[model samples]
Target: MSLLADVDFRRYWLARMVSLTGSLVTYVALPVLIYSVTGSSLWTAFVVVAEGVPYLCFGLFAGALADRLDRRRVMVIADLVNAVVLGSIPAAWAFGVLTAPHVLVVAFLTQILFVFFDAANFGALPALVGRARIAAANSAVHGGGTVLEIIVPGLAGVLITLTAPAPLLLVDAVSFAVSALLVRAIATPLQTGVPGPPGGMLRDIREGVVFLSRHSIVRTQTVIGCLQSMTGGAFMGQFVPWLDQTLGIRPTNDARLGIMYGVWGAGGIVAAVLFPRLSRRLGEPRVTLWFLPLSALAGLACGLATNWVVAAAMLGLWAIVYSMVVLTAITLRQRVTPDRLQSRVNTAGRMISFGVGWPVGALLGGLVSEATDPRTAIIWTAAMTGIGVVFAWLSPLRRLAGEPIPDADETPTPAQREPVPAPDRIEA
Candidate 1:
């Protein structure tokens, strides 16, 4: 079916686009603000760390909660909380009360809330539409976000030039508020076909872990994703520093970084447009295996680039291939997993891959960048990314020809099982 035929998907896509634009605004503004405040690159890195750490810590728990709760409500609460927290920064700045400490604190809080929002989002999607449409839905979602990533940064760069970071942050806050409202408007019911046992949070967490362990496809995908994230984290963290220090581009002064991000987004947009068609032709797993290795090589080439033009070209290719791999993976997971388990499985998958890998990779990248040249770090990261290709190659997933696409009768599992209310004994 055409993506346009799905009104709910359209609403979700539009909401995500608005939210992503705000996210991009913050993405550009935060580093600039932190740098302006401290004039220390190290401090800026620390802020980045602060933003990611909480997500890593809370991701699994958040996933379990998403499965247990009303996903739309979870999304609404998450967006509202973020809107308030994000708004506080600008308010503080306007009152001359925004301090470095305030920034760090807010960054941490924002990440914490974001972890929950992200989990709910992943968990919620399969329920909103169905497993059959996941690929197309994901394309729209990723495509919209990619388009924003391309446009918003340019807008953000212009905005930064015209005003201070605080105002941009204020705009971001409003976007979150709007996103919350949009989420609230989604009228679809979310009911998991398989319910978890009544248990405490720790018990629920354990169940999620056990579920993942038994699910081979989910397990394999998670491992591959983790490794990819590790490499990506290392590349992003170290590549700029290397370019600045080794290639003689001023990382701090140049618009090269912005160009890199924009090009990457452009690549993602291309991939998102092509993914559904590509999956149809090559099958998802084969497409993933083919593209991932090539993307890794592109990453390696990106590390080797000595000039902005070459680097931008390589990064753009990397982004395109990376987007294809990610889109393929998401489609595979959504298609194979039962609906009731989708949120938990999605959370479990991300927790193992992204939640664990990002901070460790970033930390390692920083150390490697500090001890050697950024190029060296990038090369090492590229090698790691390439190594992940082995995981894809060896797994049963590689042999997976696209199964017949799911249809309406094939009810995938839900994100959570309906709770059995207290049993009432017959008063006879």
Candidate 2:
């Protein structure tokens, strides 16, 4: 059966669609809101940094917890928590109590909760659809999000023009509540691995970290992912200001900006549709290796484009190759990770790529923007992506280019299994 035909997978997809559609609004609105409040590029970037900080602080714990608890329950609770947390934003705005710090705190807390939600989500799909369908399943998820990326930002730009960005967050809050109900209705939990003997949470997290560190392909790809994310975070952190100062686009005159965002997402849609076919032909690792330089070139073009139209086209092209890298990386991680360690290992990898990488990039982008110009900062960000190209050659991903991912039914060799600690030394 096709992955979409699976009842549980369908529910999960819808839940993701609803929540992410709303989030696309907030993603645009948050920066617009911050820029409106502070009028400082640095502060806006700082808020973006705040969004990633929680991932660093709590990622491993959240991932470990998702493995120990019912993944569905973790996702459900996370949605509910996010609803309450995001709802507070508009509530504060209504009372004239909103501040930059308030917004920063909300952004941080929401991401912390998201760490758990995402950890559960990363593991759930493979369990629901099986290893053979990982690429297709992820394509659907990424494709849906990309579609929203195309639609939501244009709508959000219009809405932000008509109304304030603060009120739009309420929509995000409501969407989360709805997503919780949908997630709760999924009959089968995705991460339904047989329960192992109880290990301390720290121990569980350690096992995941060890697995990632020791696996050659996983380790190498993960580092490359971090570099890619750093560039990505920098681009996003500066995109709004770049639009305003470089292209004369603003929340009020947002058509050009919305179009750029939509075009980029459209590129992602193209990537998602083509990824499975490409992987079949070139192998997943080869796709990553080949696309990395293309992605960098796109980034370079994005930084250098003087005309908004040219910038939008470059960004759209960049999105295609960049999304391919991201989707392939996630699929690689999911395909190889043991079922029991799925959430923990996946989340640990993301902690580096997203949690740490994003903040560092954002901070550097902000500094560069403040020190020089937004355009130059963008160029620097693009230049940073080239580092990944160099790393790829040295990484195991180069060696693993044509290897097929092990099938789910295949038993792992003794070395591939996770190591166990002796009982006496084990912590409670």
Q: Residue-pair clashes per candidate, as listed?
A: 9, 0
Which candidate comes out best when scored by lDDT? 2
lDDT score, candidate 2, position 118: 94
> Residue by residue across 1-428, what tens digits does model 1's lDDT show?
47656677667777898888898888878867876787554555556567667767887788788777777888889889999999998899888988888888888898888888877788678777776677888998888889887888766766676678776898888999999888888776654453345557676666667656654455667788888887777765554456567666543445555666688889999999999899888877678789989988998898888787888898889899988887877777767666655666677777777667765676677677767767887788788886789888987565454444332235323321122233521100
TM-score for each prediction? 0.87, 0.95
Residue runs of model 2 more than 4 Å from their true location after superposition: 195-199, 408-428
Candidate 1 wrong stretches, greater than 4 Å: 192-200, 239-257, 401-428
Best by TM-score: 2
Please report, as a residue range, the 10-residue window in candidate 2 with the lowest summed lDDT. Answer: 419-428
